[model samples]
Target: MTQSKEIKKPSSGLAARIFRQQMFIPLAALFLLALFNFIMDPSFYRISFDYNSVGNPVLSGNIISILDAGSELAILAIGMTLVTAATGGQDISVGAAIAISGSVVLRVLCGTNSRPDTLQAPIFVAILVSCVVAMLFGAFNGMLVAYFRIQPMVATLILFTAGRSIAAWINNNELPIISDPSFGVFGGFIPGIPIPTPIFIAAGCMIVIALVLRFTNLGLYVQSVGINESSSRLNGLNPAFIKFLTFVVLGLCVAVAGLIKVSRFSSINYSVVAKDIEMDAILAVALGGNALSGGKFNMKASIIGAYVIQFLATTLYKFKVQSTALPAYKAVVVILLVVLSAPKVREYLARIGKQIRQKTHVKEAG
Candidate 1:
């Protein structure tokens, strides 16, 4: 019996360690969501091979839809995680920035025509131009926050308010449609590919960021600056540049997401494209168990949290919830998650756990 008790101790300790990890919350949430869906409807887990309109074989079902739909949010969450880590605040302008970027892509592709029979430039060129434009705007916001010491939210609000207008002006308030079939491949499925193109794009972005973090000191610098700017400066780190760089990185993410958005429709709607997506991205960061106030962060957790949010949204839609009411329902869940993830709440739970463990030890002794 004593040998069995000793053997169980290591496993229990490992479980507790995992429970206390930053990834635990998002992983638990994902498990709960999966379990709930399984209980409510086993069909939700079903995946089947199907042909799309273009006669390409594709996977279909709730899980695939969640992964496909979550791609953009996941990409955005990667950037948002870095920004939140460095600036200690969220960027509110990403959705609007996407509009501007998508508009630029259309403008370059159409080349003064609202409806183009053929692309004026290569798709890659249009994407490159839009990427540059997005980075410039990101720099603008970064300057305000990093150089002038403005709050991140307030600095980004400037672009959020006028970015759509700027996007409209880029193409003279015209909505251009691309007739080229190749453009659609970015948002849809490629020839002979079963998975959605957006999934590949998101995966590529994840790989790039992971490599950057692995090969460079960018992650450590961002964390150091975020935790204490003054101390970081003393340690020879440039807090302002680190903060500025994060916003620029986020801009790159916005441009990629915008590309996916416009390619999906092969056009742009100035007012409606990517609307309120910034909020979802911010919520993803929060749900990852990362501190909004800034410090250490877990990029993997934020990415998983993005999928969890998409999972919840898809589940609600499955139940036929009204589109307008989705935000309210999400808001309630967000409140619960945020409160449970609070530091004080975690501390209280830990104290209770310790007490329980002590009592169990005493019982064993008796």
Candidate 2:
């Protein structure tokens, strides 16, 4: 009986430790949000849905928008996570890639001279073309980084600035409207609920990526190469090939996210569609509990980070204390949140908590 108890105790402790490290930050953030909202307004728990309104009532009252914000983060962070893991690098041109994706779709489907109703292409073909363009761009970055050993930032930086210019050149820096029935799937809504098509697309991407990384030997190869390229190569894993592949996938993700952005706005402004979106992607990856050094990547954690960021933004706007300084406020909160969210820090607290409990029990016995 004693031996069984001991085994179970250790297992339980290990599980608790794991949950605390992974879940604490997101849960605490949500708790703080609830407490703050409750303190500010007693009816913070209020929830409602009205589907019968004539001019189209929101299905879940913007819940889809919150998820949509997270979806953008998920797509960008997928690339960031892979690159950071494989090559020990960060791709700063994430936003630029996204701009190119949206711009290409708009220009091809809805040219500046053409109305939103102009061009009609199959969705799969459009997506495939965008993915190819994104892959070429990402491959360009990989060549520089892998062959010349350039800083990942600098290598991607070349495209980061130039890519936007190229997108603007295509669009004449104007917003192009999207009216194809195929494109409309992205923003379609069921009577009571606004189904953000982008959100579903993003979810599909997450499923595909998760499936790829979880069930394949390729996942093992990338992780081994990420931890140590030389050893992985000696063991016959090709680091160069993995890095190249990761960037290509990253670019594809950026491209899809861009398409969604354009769809959401119903137009593409080459300049405005993806400004500073790279920051959101990076922050999402970090907030998802990834280390700056990289080795492990967690899709679910990243997804949560995306949602958390959006949640914070929405919570702020809902309070109506809106101001331009909100970004600054968000920055500060994120910094603090990130610090507290560290796995090491969470472990330390759990240790202290266990010690304190032991002492309290001893005192009671005495």
Candidate 3:
């Protein structure tokens, strides 16, 4: 019995260490969600291939839907994580920014017509134009926050309020629809591919960011600036530029997400496109155990949190939760997650774990 107890100690200690890691919160949330769905209905984990209307084999099921639909949110969460870490605040304008970016893509594709028989510009050209437009808008917000010293949420609020209106004004209050099937490939599945295109796009973005983080000092600079801007500046880092850079990077992310959104429908809805997604993106950051007030962050955790959120939504839908009531249900879960992830609560839990471990050792000795 003593030998068995000693052998189990190392594994138990390792698990406790893992539980104390920043990634633990999001991972635990994912596990719980998966377990809940498995308990409620094992079919929720089912994945099968089927041909679409275009005769392309594509994956289907609740799990696939979560990955497919959550792509945009995951992309946005990457940028949101950086912006939150650097600015110590959330950007409330991302949804509106997405609208503006999507509008730009349609405007470039449709040219002077509301419904175009053919694309006026190549798909790549439209995407590039939208990317520039989104980056410019991101720079504008960064200027206010970094240079003008405005609060991040307040600075972004300017665009949040008028972005949809600006999106409408971009195409003269017209809804532009692209008739090209090639454009749909960005949001849908490619020929002979069993997975959604957005998933690939999101994966590409993840790869790029991963490479950047691996090869550059961007992560270190962001964390240093976030932890202490004054100290970072004294250490030769340009705090202002770092902050501005994060927002610009976020804008680039917004452009990608907007492309997926408009491509999903092959059209733009000025007011309805990507609406209220900013809140979800922020929630993703929080759910990943990243501090709302800024410091360190886990990009992978935030991405996972994005998918977890999509999972939660899918679960609710499966249960026939009304769309209108979805936000309220999500809010309750958010509140619980936030409370449990709190530092005070974690410390308390750690204390209880230590005591339990000590008691176990005492009983074994006796």
Candidate 4:
């Protein structure tokens, strides 16, 4: 069973050339950010010793804050990546999911009506309940996007419309105080690393998802359906079921993001929480180089994009600039990055380019 094979290389490889040219934009952006930050604040680069000197393991320093914030984004991005790549859909409801899912956690575990003595239950109960409810929300999204054949964009719209409103309704539109000591653990830093607990959870989630997508049969099925559902179906794949599974996963992700939001705020908000979160996931997936039309999946790239977006925001905040303008600026930057990272259009253009070159050569020799 030991067969030797030669490594193959295409004669006309343009990928190397193109990737080099395209990398300039992201590179330049990072360079400029570093330059700007370095010129202004010398202390910005000083890594804090807060991680080791912390009393509460979670809220030690900026390192964990960034990770805590990233957990919400990371959770959302994983689902968004799945939706966009494997399920052939997108959801604007995740922002709503953040609110709805977290509201469920707060209300179920620490509702105002609960006996004051039992308001603070073990954190595990709230965590488990939040995850289950989140899956339900994701399943709801799957029913629309996968089973009904509704446009993925429109299908998740149902959640987009009323998800946050309902989340707000649960808490009477005010932030509910969570009194659970165990659940409160999530808001603190780890003993060693300055990283927040939420970040560790998010990192764990990323690892799990990445493993699932790589080793299991689900991975093959996902790429198959995303590449060509018709072909995969002819080959005995259940495209509908696979797609449904993915949306359910998406729901779980939204729920996780909502959980992170809750942990970050230590409460629940219906009116203001998780507003416009779908955009963050979309940007992360897009920037990660995942195809908009669906094909290869890049979980690592998506994580990087999430970090980049967060850092961009951090940079702006550290400079005392009006943060309100960030959304628009980030969007513009992302759109351009998407345009540059796009592989398909460039392939098509390259094909046409070859044809024209052949024709021109023929005319010159003729």
Candidate 5:
């Protein structure tokens, strides 16, 4: 008789996958909050279609609105994920960078004085100029962090403090408007489409990032540098170059997000274009279960975290909570999730579980 070896079946369950990916806490919190909202108001999950004042078909519902409004944050989180992974630092100047980019768009659309003559500027020109300027700004930050070895926060803070003021100078302190119906298509919806265009833009950006990371060594290099810069250098990877490129890519994200924001209103306001959004983007990256100390990262988790933050804020608003108090509510939920996901807490739980199993096994044996 021949001896046979037994093969075990692979575990493929939702719980197993969640645990394996370390996403159990975030996913569980997401579902719990969603269920709570649904229980409080059965209509919370309901979606309905309607027409806007312009006679275009539109999606009208809380969930739709949340995704639509959260697109910018989602986009920013993608860029933030890369920067955090490569440089082990978050860009706090994203809002300012976008403000500057939006202002560049405005200057292109309406010129220095924001006159109708400037409206003749081609939309492509405006977009291109904005992207270039944003990239330059990003490169500036990258130079400081990569070449000068300055702290990422301190390097970016320079732009953060002066960005809007620079925007004011760019437009000569006058608001610039695109004044084209076509411009609204990017911010709102295409003709005859019920979905918001920003959603598609965000999705497209995400797909591009995923493809780039999937098909190239860029992701590997980033993580390697993040984990150990000296080791990466020894392996022929240029950490400085990688870090610089990360910021440049993030600049692209800021440009795209700024375009959508300005397109939404067809104008740029230097004072409030992307104010305070940097904090939210950073929070999204952190909440996505990425270590702020760098090393490994998951863009998908950051994306989910972006949606979670938006959903939490939306739900809070639905519950009649004051707008000012929404941040506090978010803090409570985020704190709970973080605590539950802490390594120490998980290890303690595992110890207790093992003890229970041991006791049960002993009793069964007896």
Candidate 6:
């Protein structure tokens, strides 16, 4: 009986530890969703190799497709994670910002001609200029929020309303189609690579950010500012500078996402490019077990959350759900996940755990 009780204690403790993990909730949801998909169709997660129109090898399947599609959101989520960590606020203008950047890329490419065949000197210039434009836009939001002490949502709302129009104006209200084949490599696949290039781009961004966070004091400083700006300042950290820097990083991410979006179709539609992505980016951050109120963050969890969102959307469409109705269904699931990850729910679970342990101890003693 004593041996049995000891064994049960270890198992219970292990279960409790697993449940306490920050990534546990999102991981569990992803697992359950994957299971559901498998049950619905045994081949849902299967991957296969195929040749593209250009005779290049490519990975094709639902699972690979989901990851490929989620790349843009995943990249945006990393920036959103940093911004949320430093400012305790989410950016509502990321979608608009993406539009502006995408337009900049095309506007520069189309300079001197509507469609250029070869990758000219102008493409590189366009990429640089677009990234700068995005950074400036981000700085504007930072100034409003940090310098003027405006709320992030309200501050970014200005760009949210006019960013698309600004993008349209940049391109003279023309939807430019890029005629370069090499440009598609960023969004599609390279000759020797079977996986999508956006996956590599997203992975590279994550790696760079991960290394920065791991090797430097930026992570600590950002968390300090987010947790308490006064305390951060008193500790000799520049809270305002940290906040501004975070927005700039987000702007860079916006440029990358925009470039990928344009490369995907080799075209830009100012009206619909990157529409409503801010919602997905915020949802990814929240579902990743990070607090919306700010402070500490986990980038890996957020990336997983992004993929989960894409998977959910893909699954919904597989079930014959209409495009318009997809948002409603996804929202319902997101709300439930967010509520389950709430601090109150976690505290209650902790309380119940203690009670259960106490009951088990009493039983063993008796």
- lDDT winner: 3
Error of model 5, residue 347, in angstroms = 1.9
Model 1 segments more than 4 A misplaced: 1-12, 360-366
Stretches of candidate 6 exceeding 4 Å from the true structure: 1-7, 116-120, 352-366
In candidate 5, which residue pairs get closer than 3 Å at backbone N, Cα or C atoms, i.e. clash? none
- How many residue pairs clash per model? 0, 2, 0, 9, 0, 0
Q: Give the 10-residue window scoring lowest on summed lDDT in candidate 6.
A: 1-10
Model 4 poorest 10 in a row by lDDT: 1-10
Which is the winner by lDDT between candidate 1 and candidate 6? Answer: 1
Off by over 4 Å in 5: 1-17, 115-118
- Residue lDDT tens for model 1, 1-366: 333434478876777689788999999999999999999999999999999887999988888888888999999999999999999998999999999999999999999889989989999999999999999999999999999999999999999999999999998998898989999999999999898899899999999999999999999999998999999999999999999999999999999999999999999999999999999999999999999888788899999999999999999999999978999999998998888888898799989866777677787789
lDDT of 6 at 261: 95
**What C-alpha lDDT values do all the predictions have?**
0.93, 0.73, 0.93, 0.71, 0.85, 0.90
List, residue by residue over 1-366, the lDDT tens digit for candidate 6: 334435677876777688878899779989999999988899897899989889999999998889899999999999999999999999999999999999888878777555766644566788899899999999999988889989999999999999999999988887878878877888999888999999999999999999999999988999999999999899999999999999999999999999999999999888888888999999999989988889999889988999999999999988999988999999899989877778798799889867766777788789
Sort every candidate by lDDT, greatest first: 3, 1, 6, 5, 2, 4
Candidate 4 lDDT score at position 263: 71
* Candidate 4 TM-score versus the reference: 0.81
State the weakest 10-residue window (summed lDDT) of model 2. 1-10
Residue-level lDDT of model 5, residues 1-366, one tens digit each, is: 001111211332333355657455556667887899878998998899999999999988988988988899999999898999999998999999988998888787776456564376788998999999999999999999999999899999999999989988887888876767887788999989999999999999999999998999888888999999999999998999999999999999999999999999988888888777898898888888888778898888888888888888898898899987777887787778778678898788768755665666577579
Model 3's alpha-carbon lDDT is 0.93
Name model 4 segments beyond 4 Å from true. 1-42, 51-54, 57-64, 112-120, 172-174, 190-193, 342-366
For each candidate, give its TM-score against the true structure: 0.95, 0.84, 0.95, 0.81, 0.92, 0.94
Better of 2 and 5 by TM-score: 5
Candidate 5 Cα RMSD (Å): 4.8
Q: State how far residue 291 of model 1 sits from its true place (Å).
A: 1.1
Quote model 3's TM-score: 0.95
RMSD (CA, Å), each prediction: 2.2, 4.3, 2.1, 6.7, 4.8, 2.3
Q: List the residue pairs that clash in candidate 1.
A: none
- Looking at model 3, residue 245 earns an lDDT score of 99
Tens digit of lDDT per residue, candidate 3, span 97-121?
9999999999999999889899898
